[model samples]
Structures are given as structure tokens and as C-alpha cells.
Target: GQQVMQIPQYQHVQEGEDFTTYCNSSTTLSNIQWYKQRPGGHPVFLIQLVKSGEVKKQKRLTFQFGEAKKNSSLHITATQTTDVGTYFCAGSTGGFKTIFGAGTRLFVKA
Candidate 1:
């Protein structure tokens, strides 16, 4: 069995402040996918990190995959009210099996 874990189960940041969430897996992953689910909205795919030690960014957001392929992180450079959401990390071991982390709920205060 495999498991994906995420932390800082909840985060609260003032507008313009930075925030981050981390994810870890019990076993090495083939790829890791990040998603954000807004209030009352379904999870929307953000990005996928497939290479070890890979890093990607989308505007104010940055994503990273561990060198071991067993950890990942998502960082927001500046918090905004619209950034409030539950961020989830899904680690795929190969084939069709993917384990999702519990998710980190982010609250951006204005």
C-alpha cells in the first residue's frame, strides 16, 4: 500500500503574504499532480511534475518535486482572496494508481 501526506492542514495568510504547502509519499512516485479546489467548485488541475527535482511556476504560484520523487511543494508568492482554496497533491506510482493527499486548506485574508 502507498500513501500521500500533506501538511499544514490549514493555512491563513494576509493579502500580499506568502504561503506554502508540502506533500510527501510513502513510496517513490512516477509523477505528481497539483490541484486547487475553490469554495463550492471542483478541483482544477494546476500542474504536473514528472521529473525529479523539477520546478514549475504559474504566475504567483510555484511548484516543486523532490529529488527523491517522494515529496513535493506548492508555494504562493503573494496571497490573494481569490487564492483561497483546498490544494491537493496526487502522486501516481505508475499505471492507473494515484494516491491523493488529504489536502491543505488555504485562507487568504484581505
Candidate 2:
């Protein structure tokens, strides 16, 4: 069985600050996905990384996959109240099921 784990289960930052969350897996993964769940909302897919050491970005957000395919990270630059939510990293070991990490909750203050 494979498992995905995220660090700093929670993060709190003032507006305009930066935040980051790390994810690790128990086994090598074929692909890794990132999702964001806004308060009172469902998880929404943000991005997916399949290549070793892959990196992607969307405006102020950045994502990375480890070369070993067993780890990942997400970083948000310039925090805003609208960015408050839970971020989750999911990994698939070339299987039908994708294991998700305990989401990292982000709290932003003005």
C-alpha cells in the first residue's frame, strides 16, 4: 500500500506573505496531483506532475515533484485572504486508487 503525507498540517500567514507545504509518499508514485479546497467547498484540482523532478507554476503558486517520484511540494507567494483553504497532495502508484495526504490548512490574515 502507498501513502501520501504532508507537513505543517496547518499554516498561518499575514497578507502578502509566502507559504509552503511539503508532501512525501511511502512508495514511488507514477503521478502526483495537487488540489485546493476552499472553506466550505470541495477539493478542486490545481495541477498534476508526472515527470521526475517536474515543476510547474500558476501565477503565484508553484508545484514540484521529487526526482524519486516519492515527494512533492507546493508554494504560494503573496498570501491573501482568498487563499485561505486546505491544500492536498495526492499520489498514484500506477494504480486505480490515489492516496491523498492529510490536507495542509492555510489561514491568511489581513
Which numbered prediction scores highest in lDDT against the true structure? 1
lDDT of 2 by residue, 1-110 (tens): 67788998999899999999999999999999999999899999999999999999999999999999999999999998999999999999987899999999999999
C-alpha lDDT of residue 22 in model 1: 100
Give the clashing pairs for model 2: none
Evaluated at residue 86, the lDDT of candidate 2 is: 98
Whole-model Cα lDDT of every candidate shown, in order = 0.96, 0.95
Over all chains combined, what TM-score does candidate 1 have?
0.98
Q: Write the per-residue lDDT of candidate 1 for residues 23-50, one digit (tens) a residue.
A: 9999999999999999899999999999
How do the predictions measure up, each by TM-score? 0.98, 0.98
Off by over 4 Å in 2: none
Stretches off by above 4 angstroms in model 1 are: none
